[model samples]
Target: MSLAPRTCPPVYTGSHLDTVPQGGKYDGALGITVPLAIANYWHQLGYRPVRPLCIIAFAEEEGTRFGKVCFGSQALTGKLKGLDPTALMTREGQNLPELLQASGLTGNPFTPHFPPGKCFLELHIEQGNALETAGFPLGIVSAIVGIRHFTLTFTGKANHAGTTSMDLRHDALAAASSFITHVYNSALASQRQYVATVGHIKVEPDANNVVPGKAEISLEIRSETDTLMDSVLAGFQEFLDHTAQKYGVAYEIAKLDQIPPLPMDASLKDLIAEEAQAQNIPYQVQPSWAGHDAMILGHELPTAMFFVPSKGGISHSPEEFTPSHDIGQAAQVLEKVLRRVSAE
Candidate 1:
């Protein structure tokens, strides 16, 4: 376990709004800390595990700085494509490779070192209402929703807002607004665990006096099944095309990221569930809406995840919280899973 220099931007490097908080020091930081504590406890007990245990601290899981998510784990799982350190630039035009060199990681940005493991498990706080709503202290994740991101650009004629008259103007923003509503409605109609978000929107020459000529929006869709996602995406495309035609605008969809949903190892999930039951810690099975390192590692080996309730379903914020008791319970469940897997 050697510390590697981070190739991605630091989590809270002067971003506009802080998604992570400084309150309890146990949000993302504890994911690494608890594992180390467990390992130290095992070592102190003079118990040599049958299998090797490696505690990993993944970089850029929050994706706050870089516009990409899961940068560290994706690199390890060989899922990242067209990643060039030199070509990478921040909002301030800072070079990524230079940043990595400044931090002192001794390897190519494209290549990551991963330890061979018989199984992988991550203990994290559930960033949603599943556990809290179910009156449970812990959750055994069944699967992680796959995510697909698309950048949609609509091109129309920029014209005078006042003189353009009623029907003569082709407004990109109006067309985009229609598409956005449709995206939401379509997801609801699917009646499944589907989520669609329009997180970013920008209009070229953002002036109130002029009709928007070009509008760009970032959209994301997540689902547990690839087939369901495909159907949703296809419908989204149709909506885009229809809206463009109706508004007499040119539109294109560019894919930013696509991560297929990951299913956790059933046996491991069951083991954690059994452990929770035996310990009298209320637990339930649920799906992860947010992607994580476990999703990436699940591609290679047996992987599972446990979640503790996040206060108010808040995460990625300084206010994100889980009680110490809940954290201890989740860690205890993880210890059982580790012990069981290591013995085999």
Candidate 2:
């Protein structure tokens, strides 16, 4: 939150409360702590910003058991208007209106609205090894990647595992496995612009003594552009069709979800780069592989994001970490950017 008096709406700097299941400690947490630390430093010096500056934290950002994604950002921006509050329930069944009332969702430190040209800057762990591998302490994000989800089902004749000969069997799981391999290998060959994952699978009779008769797969694909994702989907479908035919299985696909990519504010990126150079902090430009609230706010406001390195490029796990040196460097650059942007 801004240390200055709220004579008017403030410029914002903060991060969402990342509730991604198995999320790393720094994912949504450090972004807030570092800003709060800066706010405290300003208070200790009895200094007020030239413009109102706020440090706000958003929760339920990951849609992980906590609830739907980016709840706080969407709500504050009035994206929830006209929707039934009761219909938007938390994982625990807490309604939107009630949750806002219960949490006192708006006011001093929690305000989301600000001057249109003003900015929202966030600092986060890169969650990938882009910076870590390059030995950079910080990064300026270019864009947040888009995501697509698909469910593919395969059907084949079931037969006794002991009785069915290998030459006469139509194995659905085999076809699905080959399709998954194709998906992964193709994504890997897409020059890092595309990534695909098949994390969920279900097989009928799930038994040791049975030849699988049906299989279902949940496939996720991500990229910076819709066109690339669409092309990738087409290629994957072709491969799946051929693999299913070879295995004598029939297959179908369903689209589950999609979110388009959002680019960060260019002017803000320039400021961040200027600050990093001024502070002598090594930095580079990268894109966020994971979704974030900044993407939500970017739709309505000028938002920018910077990143520190995630140890081993690991995220969404207990091993997620960043060194204090890298973290401090990030905070330093952020504080400088905050001072410059708010003063302007």
Candidate 3:
């Protein structure tokens, strides 16, 4: 549907529609479904808010298809005004520019625009068992965690695996392995509740008879505080220095991205909390471990998130599940929040 105003809407309820490969049913879709349900409820009741209510089903949030997280939100925000669609391709080898052209977006450019004035609220699965484990149906998101990404590369001399002596030969993959171990242990010891992952890795000449000459791993760290993420990053750098020396290898660190933690609007968060209590739904205020479109839009609007418990702290997989009751409860809080914000 076309926007009624060129300017920002006073109220917005949206979530992404895309999912990762083999992704669960609830991850991005639940957020959109809940808001749409609320809009439909208001329509059935012939009720109207003080201002316009916009329901947006944003696309490509997972970025799994093209490796661009928050694609839809970024475009709506005008961040993609000059994006070169031809430079990106889907996993299935589909050309982005061609796809857009086919969808009738050839000459026209995309402008950033999910513009919200008074508030934006997103309801999503907790993606963790926090609420479920705590016996609460819903959660009030106080903040979204900050994220830092880096690429760590290790370089060493290639040698025949059979001819290389254990102490004399330098192995890039070995050094990479040590760094990964260090990351895991350090995260476990974090007092700031940090999570560090070396999820992607590759080694050159991946042969059983050849020593790896180079290894690269993608490193990501997340926490509620930027300072904490920095602290960990610094420590990792130091450890890498020692690792390079110890393994007789050289290392390089290339920084990729950093997303600062975003605190939800105080009043919006409080409103959700208050409404939860009023509705007799138990709630916990917590920080989101995973990223969300809410975090991106939070920078543009007074935003907040409501989370329903995932059955087993699972998400982004077919196993992800949230009870129907939990979803209904979270939706109720979002509806109440919208009503309160609209009146203000």
Candidate 4:
């Protein structure tokens, strides 16, 4: 049978775990090693792909050093602009641009992105319990949740905690606490697959004697549906307004980042399902709560991700693990999908 060969160059065939200091071994390594295993199997069987496959190992996906996640992918796609290299200083007090120039790269690092034709697949350990709880060995990702992050500040008049009467105090910390409660309640009440969290909070004048006059919190909202996320944000804004008025505090919010939800390629997902069935591997289709480089590149190219079950659905920890059988099943399915794509 004549096959249409894929022509994409520099396929990202690498482990993508640069962030999450002391991350699980399989989080990034499996995605890299599985493809190599498949290639070795094909070679042993005297099978050759119609298209050239190149494996690349990238070390900068975590963006811990530059404060930019998916640094390599984003840079190559020209998604990063107006970057002041001199302003970006490392923890060692070194300018990032100067470091790049010293390394023999002296131009605008951002380049125009070209759609590298189809055939992008990422195999990862499911960071959630969906697969394991459902007793599925493998899973095809349906979509990646959209993410919105914000920094909120609540400001009020600081005063002596012991002298301030309960009714007379314009407590920013109290208002912030109410907001945090609302966030939890709303998330629980949301009918859709939505989650809102106030993970970080700081109280100003954090002293036993001083009433907090300023509070800052880090808020993050995630949902598979953009419309749902927008609705949640609207409701949250209203709550924030009400809280500020209740405690006589002034509130401000600064948006940090917003990434839209991404749906997987329908045809590719179907192919993955077929391959799983053909291999007698139990699989499911699920939404990914966490972000990945696959989703970043998936927006521009036809990309697919297969997941192996994580023990107790835990990931990004030193104890994170996936059983060998689950890994094998996922790898086999990925191998089949790659072969089929190559033959198409």
Candidate that would win on TM-score: 3
Minimum summed lDDT over a 10-residue window in model 1 is located at: 9-18
Ranking by TM-score: 3, 4, 2, 1
| Cα error of candidate 4 at position 297, Å | 0.7
Model 4: how far residue 17 lies from native, Å? 5.3
TM-score of 3: 0.90
lDDT of 4 by residue, 165-240 (tens): 9999999999999999999998988754798889899999988789899999999999998999888889989998
Global lDDT of model 2:
0.83
Clashes of each: 5, 2, 5, 0
**TM match of model 1 to true structure:** 0.82
Show where candidate 4 strays beyond 4 Å.
1-19, 81-89, 94-115
Candidate with maximal lDDT? 3
Show the colliding residue pairs in model 1.
19-316, 19-317, 20-318, 21-317, 21-318
For every model shown, what is its TM-score relative to the native structure?
Answer: 0.82, 0.87, 0.90, 0.89
By how many angstroms RMSD does model 1 differ from the true structure? 6.3
Expressed as tens digits, the lDDT of each residue in 1-344 for candidate 3 is 12234353578887989888899999878888887888888878777776677777888898887898988888787778887767788877887778887798765345655554767888888888778878888788889999989998899988999888999889999999999999999999885488899999999988889999999999999998888887888898899999999999999999999889999999888888899999899888889999988987898888988788898898888898888877887888888887767654
Global lDDT scores for all candidate models: 0.76, 0.83, 0.84, 0.80
Clash count for candidate 2 is 2
